[model samples]
Target: MSAPSSRSPVIDTVKGLACMAIVWHHLAFYGPMSDIAQPLAPGLMAFLYDYARMAVQVFLVVGGYLAAASLAPAGTARFAHAGSAIGKRFVRLMVPCAVALVFTVVVSALVRTWMNHPSVPEAPTLAQLVANALMLQDLLGEDALSAGVWYVAIDFQLFSLSVLAWAWVRALPGRWPQQQRAALARGLIVAGAAASLWFFNRVAGLDMWALYFLGAYGLGMLAYWAVQSSRPHGWLAAIVLLGGVALALDFRGRIAVALVAALGLALAQRMQQTHSAGRTLPGWADGLARVGQMSYSVFLVHFGACLLVNAVVGTLWPASAPINALGMVLAFALSLVAGRWMYLRVEQHVPSWATALRWQAGLVGTGLLVALLSNGV
Candidate 1:
């Protein structure tokens, strides 16, 4: 959609809510605190553990929507320098990611001594550290240094894939009509999404690649175009059909979540377009939007924050369900605080190659140092 440069309250609100879900999902999924607290609210813990992870589907769709908005609002490549754009995107994602990983590695090391829980990642090898810094840990068969870090890698891959697709369309020979060019570009996205939904996504082994998640991501791109089109209903219907057929063929709850999120985004944007005057949101919504704006920071740092809280709480009150429940709450609060700090100090700043490299080096260096110190001790 040809959205205004101004931020969308709807998108931000969705992100904020999804971010909260992910944080809570991790809290419930990774234990000690959740283990101790589950007796108090078994059903609630079970639901969070099982269902809340689907919130990531919302992020995938939103990521696609934003990628389309930035890369090709009119269905053609907007930027001339594909390589430069890809590089910039990498730096933008990894600078903050590296910083967060360093924190996570350090926290994991500190927690390893006293907390022999499965949630604490073991000491990193140099290879593992380097792989993680390069966002290749999954591909290299190394354990993730933190929860949800895989999303950061997948995000970069999806963005790069989208950029390359648009760049390919833009490079086609002959004076093709702009409409035809746009159609070709969109056709590629549709085909990729279909391949993902019908094939790659079904194969668990392919989860490390962008193709496996393109179904959700492509729905987001389509949703953006649908919102921009005069015949939005028709485009929206196509989205529904695509997702419906995929689900009918093979029912995946994550895919359904993605489909719903994409449709919700389209409908919300349409409503905003129809009522342009009432743009101001209520205070709570405004707060949510703020959280959404910084959601990436929260996502990056929360595992370490929650880990620290878990270690402390489990040590002091291992048998107290109420105390452990309160510890969960405290962990959530600390995650928010840590997220705000990261957003303000790191994410909000414009990223650079130097900054990204320095942070990456720091992550690897710190990880090696931790390993060495642990060995000496």
Candidate 2:
């Protein structure tokens, strides 16, 4: 019998987990693990630093795939069509960002109040907020407006790039059928991904700026194109692409491991939908949908929580690596709880709150801009 049709909560759970991983990494790396997770810490800590964030690349790649798949149907978004997708993304990201910025400011403010320490910087100005409002903060050499603005900024930049690429493809042979166009697009995307990695490590010294937003997003686009195309070959292509990344970058084994884990999860989800397991997955699907829903918020706020926890831990615990490691554990516990709270309250308000205010979670777009303006950058 065909595998029961199933829904994939795995993806959503992965997103949620990835956010937590980032949180732990930041907390451990900056706060305690240097001493704690280092010699005292296990190899897993090292593995995460080396490879876990690459899992984030998986998210980006998948997003790119799904986006391209959607675009395959519509071809591409025009200026008008682009507005809503871009706008919604903006809202989703900015809301949690705003909340984090406010939370950070409050924390910063409290520190100043208690310590009377003039050493800490004040909140950012209106001009800075304006820049962040347009998602220009990161591009302008500003520190992340909060902590995780990179993900949103990069994703948006990639989305824009994808649209442009699609436009260019459309202009060429201007009448090629979708199949041929998709194949060409996939080839181009792979080439671009390779070029992106090469240029980043070799040319830009692995600087984030030199990397192509499209390349990362394009990875997903390419995958989606393959999975949805006549050949429908996602699994093998992902392995090949990741292999290229490994060989070219001299990636440690952790990255390869992350790639497999992520791909397996993606495939499992796909199988649940397409196979006989489909019925076994609706609950997971619904749950994942919820997790996916809160992903943007978690991504934005998790790091800041880490920072705060790191600071407090450093202030209270041993400054040495071992002591800092303890702090990281504490931070993880705190951030996990705090992250969930922010998602539930700040990012994921109840239906009543949403309906009562007649708000569509859209206010977060403006709110984040305000926080950015309020924070120094």
Candidate 3:
């Protein structure tokens, strides 16, 4: 195991940049507002629309890296309480996600009333609402209530699967020597990852399942393990070799992106570990790091922000290029502000207060449903 260092500003910076990119992409890729903005810079909007979604790879790799660090920092595969770990992860993700879903539901309904834009989601059904609250929309074959929310479900799946894999390793027969057991555990994990990359990842039919994305997620875990290896060159070489084989088997742009992100994170980890104490980020980088910290909240609320902005802009200007363009910019800026607000006001409170908040949110949702039914809405 390696000694932990201060949080890397670089990772946070990457996250910040990615968050901005995603918001920009969404603003430029969806709705009549984007239609107005597109003519202003068609080429740039097209490129961002086509490619900005790849930023998700960065988050996936980072998630895997952090999961490994928390669950098996030593790569010992000793997960004494995998269930507890999974429960904690679910709460951390779901509490904020559910709250965000409620916001999405309300904003979507408002937009539907104000505009006939293609981007506005339909009035959310009770079943769809329940599925989204549980983050099972993808697996349950329900339409998503919000843009980019599928990633939240995938994040939970990846964490749960990784922990369960470790638990399975821990449950293996006890007669084996400790060293042998550890080696076997690591080998099994690698095997699963390799299978995912070579086989499951190629099956488009399975994309909704956790295993479909596990290939990239596993590459992240492998990156962490490689960086921690005593035989650095050999470990890295093996990682490169395995990744090469996976690509050779079937080239996937997203997987390739994930591999690159994993390598970048590993390199950053190496540099940070080698550096002495007192390493600090410059002012701009520190600002980006703050964005990274609130990236999840930003991601969650940005759709709602965009919807509200679109309704207002459409009412006032109705596709006048300049005003809509300005609205796009306003939407982007306000998303950051709202994301920070949500993070500070809601997400940060989840650790000690999630249970209370969950109940409160449920009651609110129930009351809203009753009122809607009463009005025949």
Candidate 4:
């Protein structure tokens, strides 16, 4: 195995934890809000779990950070090349998203057909499927295949915004001053958050499709690239952490989220300072790293597993809070297994094969294989 770096392994661990928390959240899929509102199992477990959605801010923040760092090298003159950075990023997220979209179309349609809801509200199809396959559902304001899929749009838009922000900083290096780009990020995050709060409170419910999520992502990216790096002067990190929690508790969502994202990225930077590659056998972390590698697939495939499992179990056995919890546990276990399988078989193996296949039969064979797999299967 390649020696694990300071950032990647820790980020992988965080991803694993985030994905697991997401699974727990989705367990409430089939039930009413009252089901969750009436719980306090395992002491404060319910409260902790309920609030864990807050951690997704870390994922968005870290994602932005990594993407920004990748774009901006620590060199002399000129900003990083934008075209190359964006192209590489597009492939990294897009390939798996495409695979997930195709997989969702095939499976959701089958499930809907199986549940005898062939004409039900949530039934899947080829054209609607194509739109999702292209990640344009959110663009067109159409429905989403899954709840979490909207994040794809958020990630894409934030990516463009991050690039623009980077360019803006490069252009106005004077206004940004020395290494205090954190101020710029802080300013953008506050403005975006304020606007988002206004939009959410005054206009309607949580609009993930609106630019708020994108703004959060942009703020996250800005922090990732501009600030939230480098060791603090002193206990500034501790101060930030405390202040973040205080503001969040005071019912400030945007600032709290930005702070949390900053905290996670900053924490990662701090950890990197103390990082050592004790390249012994990887422990519980190895399993978690594998989960991180497959996190995209897990995030994609998990909801299907949960929906199918719940549909089957709820039909055979009456559904309740306890039943929902048990089903969620089972869904997580099954999703992990399935996700790992996809990572190893489809994702990991295909890249090495792509090169060889390109050299041999070239574009003709590649197109044929793509056509066969996408349409034939």
Candidate 5:
């Protein structure tokens, strides 16, 4: 999700919990550690493997909520410069992502020497490196260097699509009234979401594009509008009906998860608005909210951190279930530490085109160098 300029405790709590679920899902899905440790708790491991990835739907909903809040809080485009807004969003997402990719490339190379496992990626080609830097790895059919990187590309595309939609409505001819323009923009989003849930999402081949994921994202956008509307009940009911029909059509578990998350977020915002008189979160919630603030960093760097832990722990105790389980915990802790470092160093800075380009170039350059040295060139 794109980082939000302001914070909501409920949003942060949802994001923080979902971020943890995603990290554990990856650990269970890709591991020598999880493989060996499965015997200790097969049910838990299986649940994590199969169901925890639904946390991604939470992110999609949250991203849409934030996008709506930032771009059109009052149901209309607030800014005139769509290009500059889109460019800024790209730089903000890619600068941290480029740093994470470079780290993962180096980690994969090191793990490849001694750990002969499927999780370790091979040396990159120049084309692959370039494609990844440009966020075209999935579109071009190049393997990603790290887990969850595809989300970054999808996020960029979704934000761009929303920007273009709002801009198009604003540029419509013949001096339409503000209310009419806003209605047109909202209608376009609703149409896109309906198409996605009813058709595009079921195809499975269009996962790389924004259309496939727009249902969840658009629900989030509608949730934001629901919070702003005077008749919140009607808007909330519309959200449920949209997602309910999608589920009735195909019964996707992920869409169900998104629907629940979107409803929860809308309800939470409604409560916060009504009860805004000197309320403060407890200590635990404040801590979780802090984690939510740094979630993008955690999501970016956790894969590499987990890979290194997997290599070390697998080498040390390949068969001890207890030890491997402990290693999983250790990896999760280190991932948080690495994520905090990334957040403070990269994501917090004011992103610029120059800074984004430098990081992108560094990722490609380092990947090419690693490939050359691995091949004895």
Candidate 6:
């Protein structure tokens, strides 16, 4: 029988772990909590403040890996309707993100009444909301309504770019043989990734563009193909060499971390293939995988959760480390609770609106929920 098409617990564990760190990073890096907590353990807080964001590379790699697995599973460029693919991706990301944005805007307004930390976002202008809705906030120079939102736009750009890249490979002049086509496709992906890492990634002017982050994203794609290949080690080594060369040219700690994560994923896939004799997995692994599944929701909602908790702590005990630490714990716990609710209610339950009326109804429902949560009503 063919292998079961289930998610790997290892991947989910990585994602879940990253989600926790990201939540911690946000709380430790922003607000009066950071100022208070830093005095207790400056080194730890400093690490979280400076390097925890790099955990995003895990998601980047995972995104590319999944994109490749879905779009071009057999190691070749293959997409029939690029626009349709783009549209599906857009809706999948936007539905929940739009709801999260609305929630952020409302929560931000309420939190501003309690405290005025720099972490507290201002009331969004019409332009700001529209720009973020279009995922063009970075390009339009409008501030993001929530933390880590730029990644949502970047993920879309990377997916579109990757699809286009694969389509270009498939459309090359000659009708090459199967093996030749696969080789060509892999080569193009590598070239694009290398360009991003060695050139585009280094250019400060290009930071807002998807190309700048494609290097890490491409590594994830390469890793998926590598694990799926007959010779996993060879492909894994190639991925390592690509990352090594990029680092040798210009050392980037973020890229280095991404390289390691990509390697870990590749190795994990190989191990699963070799040792997964049974369908069942460890309980903790399964639990973490659920978190991985909810990671997008957590990323979208955690900032608002943080703001609410921080507002409470700030209002009651602005400079107290103990209270701030408690706030951080509550923020983390509440984010997971809220994120799970969001995943269930908004992300997955997003309506398959057959008409504009249905879509409007969904929006109205989301608005009502946000309003009720925002007010003590």
User: How do these models rank on TM-score, best leading?
Assistant: 5, 1, 3, 6, 2, 4
Residue-by-residue lDDT tens digits, candidate 1, 1-377: 11124368899889989999999999999989999999999999999999999999999999999999899999999987899989988998998899999999999889888988988888999989999999999989998899998999999999999999999989999999999999999999998998898889999999999999999999999999999999898779878988998999999999999999999999999898899757698999988887888899999999999999999999999899999999999999999999999988988788789999999999999999999988885
lDDT of all predictions: 0.92, 0.54, 0.76, 0.53, 0.91, 0.80
Evaluated with TM-score, which candidate comes out highest? 5
> In model 1, what is the error at residue 359, expressed in angstroms?
0.5
The runs of at least 3 residues in candidate 3 whose Cα sits more than 4 Å from the true structure, single-residue gaps closed, are 1-6, 77-79, 352-377
Candidate 5 lDDT (Cα, whole model)?
A: 0.91
lDDT of 5 by residue, 1-377 (tens): 65656688889988889999999999999889999999999999999999999999999999999999999887789877999989988999999999999999999989888898898889999888888898899999998889999999999999999999998888878888888888889888888988888889998999999999999999999999999999888778878888989999999999999999999999998899899746988899887787888999999999999999999999889989999999999999999999999999999888899999999999999999999888989
lDDT for position 58 in model 2? 57
Candidate 4, residues 63-97, lDDT tens digits: the string is 65555555443311134665655554455455555
lDDT of 2 by residue, 245-321 (tens): 64567654433444554355546545655767535445755654555545656566655566565556556654466
Per-residue CA lDDT of model 3 for 240-299, tens digit only, reads 766788899888787788878887778777777789647888899999988988888899
Residue 147, candidate 1: alpha-carbon lDDT: 96
Better of 3 and 6 by lDDT: 6
Q: How close is every model to the real structure, measured as TM-score?
A: 0.97, 0.70, 0.91, 0.68, 0.98, 0.90
lDDT of 3 at 262: 80
lDDT of 6 by residue, 1-377 (tens): 00114266777788888888888899887777767756777898888889898999888888888888888888675668777777767777777777787777778877877687889876555566667777899999999889988999999999988787777777778768878877877787788889998899989898789999999989998899888888777778878888999999999998998899999999888788888558666798777778877888999999998889888876788778877777788888999999999888877664342432343344445445544554546
> Clashes per prediction?
1, 29, 0, 1, 0, 0
Report how far off residue 77 is in candidate 6 (Å): 3.7
Worst 10 residues of 4 by lDDT: 356-365
Better of 4 and 6 by TM-score: 6
Model 6: pairs clashing at backbone N, Cα or C within 3 Å: none
